[model samples]
Target: MSGTELTVTLSGGSAADARAVVQALEPTFGAADERPGDDGATVHTATFEHEAADRPSDGASADAARLSAPVTVTVQGTPEAVEKASATLSRTFTTRDQGAASGDQEQERELLLEP
Candidate 1:
């Protein structure tokens, strides 16, 4: 399927906090492939299908949305996908521009999400 791949790297948080963010994203991005990072960090990588950004018709419940700890999310894909994902993430977390560096095939934006 045509879609974007997003890698969310969470550091300086407990495993529970990392998992909470991953769980919040799963309904939208599907199951993520999680791995450990240095110094008790967690990294979650997932691909979002093109339609994944569409808001649910029934609306999302408040309990389904949450985030915590310091995390850095890197979204890489077409400009459209990157923008969509960034917007979605911004709503849930306090984000600052880490950077946006582009290459020939794709573009990437780094956002730091604060607790």
Candidate 2:
């Protein structure tokens, strides 16, 4: 175990939907917290914790969900990788009027991104 932790909170997403998104990003040792049904938008939160990664210090995770506006994603990695991963995840995960419409798509998305 690397004894490392990464936490991220995102607004504008449904809890259920957000959960699905977090579930996609396989964290070494992390989980996603989603809060839905808030003024037509949803809120999603995700935490990444990996203690046994090859490079335990470089643990990273991404979470995203449907939103009234654009989806928000927060990623945390090692001090050095955090910034790069965060920027990439933020840009890649953030979306407007976009989301997975089917279970298969959602699953596929998760499989593609999760660690």
Candidate 3:
């Protein structure tokens, strides 16, 4: 099994909402080290449990979501499967964040496999 860690920084949304989105994509991405949240679903940490930060501007409406966290997904399979999983995770998160913009943007870590 090969392990890859990706720290994803999601901004411009509510912490609760963003966490829900990430949790939703977990099954499609890979197994998580640990996950929290039920029904409303907010808060998830996979494997290493990357740090998360919620930054909300006073002027920003309460509906907005701000998320910054590292998600480390580990998959067991050929290199192709691992790569596919990475791409799938990135695309899924990006797709969901598209409709959730209040001038909010999602940031992805440039370096992969780094501690």
Candidate 4:
């Protein structure tokens, strides 16, 4: 874990869709902490630790992975981190801003993703 910690939460999609959403953010956030298996649950969450705005990737394609259906993603972290994650995800998916809540230490933004 690094200084800027971001938590990504997914809902309203299949397990594969959830994984794709998580993987899409990796190019900017780096590999997330031990990705927990989804127990066929409705909500899945992953935490990522980032050092800077964008992480260094190995030329991996983050755009090929596609979602089977619509997904709602909630990114929680510092304002900078949430903004970066949202922007990165929007580039990979058709995203619409749902809403966001912010505090002194952390902020959370929710976006709807369509396949």
- Output the number of the TM-score-best candidate: 4
lDDT per model vs. reference = 0.59, 0.40, 0.34, 0.81
* TM-score for candidate 2: 0.42
Which 10 consecutive positions of candidate 1 have the poorest summed lDDT? 55-64
**Per-candidate RMSD vs. true structure?**
4.1, 11.8, 14.6, 2.7
lDDT of 4 by residue, 2-115 (tens): 578999998987888888887887777878885637687888899998773546433335563588889999999998889888877877788999999989989999999998
lDDT by residue (tens digit), candidate 3, 8-88: 332333445445434543444443454443444333333422211121112222222223443333332333333343454
Clashes within 3 Å, all models in order: 0, 4, 6, 0
Ranking by lDDT: 4, 1, 2, 3
Backbone clash tally for model 1?
A: 0
In candidate 3, residue 65 scores what lDDT?
21
The whole-model C-alpha lDDT of candidate 2 against the native structure comes to 0.40
Looking at model 4, residue 105 earns an lDDT score of: 88
The window of 10 residues in a row where model 2 has the poorest summed lDDT is 104-113
Model 1: runs farther than 4 Å from truth?
Answer: 33-44, 53-68
**Deviation of model 3 at 83, angstroms:** 6.4
Q: What's the candidate order when arranged by decreasing TM-score?
A: 4, 1, 2, 3
> Best candidate, lDDT-wise?
4
* Better candidate by TM-score, 3 or 4: 4
Model 2 agreement with the true structure over 1-115: per-residue lDDT tens digits: 3454545455443555455445434433444333233345444555565542434323333334233343455544455334333433444345332222233211111112221
